[model samples]
Target: MTRPEAPHALAITFFYYRDLPRAMQFYEDIIGLPLAIDQGWCKIYQICPGAHVGLVDETRGMNKWSAQKPVQLCIRVVDVNAWYAYAREHALDGLSELFENDQLGIRAFVFHDPEGYQIEIQSATRAGA
Candidate 1:
């Protein structure tokens, strides 16, 4: 069968949390993402032009909160150093030293959110990376 027609408009990745308000605050105040959509039980924040992340209340959401998070959220930015500095200043949980990956052509670091979700911030180090 042929692929479906029509281009996708936007993309969103949802993460469930026991405390929706706290998660919302972290994404809004700490991560500096603006709220795009606000459903009573879920809040969607815009990460960039077309990318978003949704914060959901575990009790009411499709998935329940779990301590073992097997997934990570990665975001590519123009200045990884600046972001790293911000992370350090905030004393973010599970903060890691910034490092370079030549194979990936990126300078990156990672930190955990309030509920232990790993978030990676990276910047391309070479052209077309």
Candidate 2:
């Protein structure tokens, strides 16, 4: 007998937050991701085509907020320098100097979000990277 296959329609990464409004504001006004879904206590923002980040209120969410965030959200862009310039203009928290990694074939910079989640913006340095 052959097994049935299921195809995924969308991808969403959920982040639990103590302050959902603040997180939503940062993702909306700063990160500029459009809201794809609004579930009262949860706001889902589209990062790119088919990819989204969901912000959930810890009080109502399945997971509770933790002081330490070990996960990093990385976004690959067409122009990392341009994004870095914008990030600098905003004076984002824990913003690092843009650097290149030959091994990863990326020119990238990292910064912290409102709740201290590390976010990395990168651009490919070589072809097919």
The residue pairs found clashing in candidate 2 are none
lDDT of each: 0.95, 0.94
In model 2, what is the error at residue 53, expressed in angstroms?
Answer: 0.3
| Reference-based TM-score, model 1 | 0.97
- lDDT (tens digit, per residue) of candidate 2 on 8-118: 789999999988899999999999999999999999999999999999999999988898999999999999999999999999999999999999899999999898889
The global Cα lDDT (0 to 1) of model 1 is 0.95
RMSD of every prediction: 0.9, 1.3
Each candidate's number of clashing pairs is 0, 0
lDDT of 2 at 57: 93
Candidate 1 lDDT, 29-101, residue by residue in tens: 9999999999999999999988999999999999999999999999999999999999999999999999999
How do all models score by TM-score?
0.97, 0.95
